[model samples]
Target: MAKELQKLFEDLKREMKQEFRELKESFERELRKDVRDIKASMSFINQCYEEMKASVKKVEAENEALKESISTLKEEREALYAQVKEQESRLMQNEQHSRCLNVEIKGVPR
Candidate 1:
């Protein structure tokens, strides 16, 4: 009976060692998987950061283009204003010339 008890204890110890090894292996596998997941998540975050930076750059470029366009529009407006002023002066000169001709014609016999 003593020998049987010793055998049974030895078997139980072997089984427990096997179970412990299996648990250790499972824990290591899960740890490796979690590490891989973290790495993938970090990579995705980096990609998103890069994309956001590019988008910011694009927006900045657009803003600069808009500033240039606004400046050009302002210049065009000034040019148009100058043209309108010149046309107005020409019209006034033409009106004065027409009135002078009419007065001269009426002073003459017809």
Candidate 2:
């Protein structure tokens, strides 16, 4: 009977060890899969980051070009305004000179 009990205990211990080994293998496989997924996600995120940086650079260049264009337009507008003012002043002077040359006699017959 004692020998039989020893044999049974050894058999149970072997089965338990086998189960534990299987569980360890399953855990390692799951860990490896999770690591692979994390790596893929990180790679995708990095690619997006690079693309966004390139886009920002392009937008910044465009913004600078627009600013220069606006500055040039503003300069042109000011120059045109000054020219218009000068022309108005000349017209007023000509009108005043012309009025002095006009003689109106209402009572005399033509």
Give me the candidate number with maximum TM-score.
2
Q: Which candidate is the best by lDDT?
A: 2
The lDDT of each candidate is 0.97, 0.99
> For residue 32, what is the lDDT in candidate 2?
100
- Superposing every Cα of model 1 onto the true structure, what RMSD results? 3.4
Q: List residue ranges in candidate 2 displaced over 4 A.
A: 98-102, 108-110
lDDT of 2 by residue, 1-110 (tens): 99999999999999999999999999999999999999999999999999999999999999999999999999999999999999999999999999998998798777
- Candidate 2 minimal-lDDT segment of 10 residues: 101-110
Expressed as tens digits, the lDDT of each residue in 1-110 for candidate 1 is: 99999999999999999999999999999999999999999999999999999999999999999999999999999999999999999999999998885733355665
- The TM-score, computed over Cα atoms with residue i paired to residue i, of candidate 1 is 0.74
Alpha carbon deviation, residue 86, candidate 2 (Å): 1.1
User: Pairs clashing in candidate 1?
Assistant: none
